[model samples]
Target: MIRHLVLFKLGEGVERDDPRVLEGVDAFRSLDGKIPEIRFWELGWNFSDRPIAYDFAINSGFDDADALRRYLEHPEHQAGVTLWKEFSTWVIADYEY
Candidate 1:
């Protein structure tokens, strides 16, 4: 199994209530149901003061690297990717299980 994790820091002036933020979160959470390769999905907004804490985090599970790649190319995932590029300042990742 593969675990795909992503942490995002929103761009300047972006807030929790922003449509872009909500759309990004909903888009990610919906992937498990929309894409076959996405076995699990979890997304959360940061509420901690830790420097490592980003604006949002996403954790996803896949059966293998191929499945993970497929999830990355999925249409719904692409929409989220576009939204991420528009609203995020930084994105960090680690993919290992």
Candidate 2:
């Protein structure tokens, strides 16, 4: 199995409640049941007040590299990425377990 992790930080002056940000969050949330390649999907806002924390996170599992690739290329996921591009910066990591 492989774990795919992503952490997102909102752009300067961007607030979570902004319409665009809300839409982006909803887009990602909608992916949970929409992609067959996903073995697991969990995402949420960070509640931490620490300076080093990211504003959002995506923790997902896949059966293998091909499954992970399919999920990455999925249309819905790409749409979500487009939305997020307007207001956030992110980092990702993937590894086998």
Candidate 3:
């Protein structure tokens, strides 16, 4: 399986309560049922206020690279990406276990 993890930090001057951020978060949450390639999906806001911590995270699992690719190309996921890009920047780590 492929474990796809991502950490997202709100953009400078951006707050989590911003309408755009809430919309983006909802968009991602909605993907749990919409995409078939996803074997697992977990997402949430980060509680840490430390400067080095990210504001949110996405922890997902897929059957393989192709499944992961399909999830990435899914329209709903892309829509979330578009919205999140407007208010946040993210880093990702993918690995197999």
Candidate 4:
């Protein structure tokens, strides 16, 4: 399986409840039931106030790289990206297990 992890940091001065962030959150949370390629999906807000804490995270798994590619290209995921791109920046890692 392919583990796809992502850590997201909110843009400077952006708040967790900001409309854009809320939309992004909703979009990601909806993917679990909408996308078949996603074998696993976990997404949520971060309550940590520490300076090092990212604002959000996405922990997901796919059957393989092809399935991962399908998730990345899925329209639901793309819509989430649009909202997230406006209010956050993220880093991702993909590994096999």
Best by TM-score: 2
Query: What would the per-residue lDDT of candidate 2 be over residues 28-73, giving only the tens digit for each residue?
Result: 9999889999999999999999999999999999999999999999
Query: What value of lDDT does candidate 1 attain over all alpha carbons?
Result: 0.82
Task: List candidate 1 stretches off by more than 4 Å.
Answer: none
Over 4 Å off, model 3 = none
TM-score for each predicted model, relative to the true structure = 0.88, 0.98, 0.97, 0.95
lDDT of 1 by residue, 24-66 (tens): 7787777768898977788888889897678888888888889
- Candidate 2's displacement at residue 15, Å, is 0.4
Clashing pairs in 4: none
Order candidates by TM-score, high to low.
Answer: 2, 3, 4, 1
Where is model 2 poorest over a 10-residue stretch in terms of lDDT?
Answer: 32-41
Q: Relative to the true structure, how large is the alpha-carbon lDDT of every model?
A: 0.82, 0.97, 0.94, 0.92
Best of the two (2, 4) by TM-score: 2
* Residue 24 miss distance in model 3 (angstroms): 0.2
Best by lDDT: 2
- In Å, residue 38's CA in model 2 sits off its true spot by 0.6
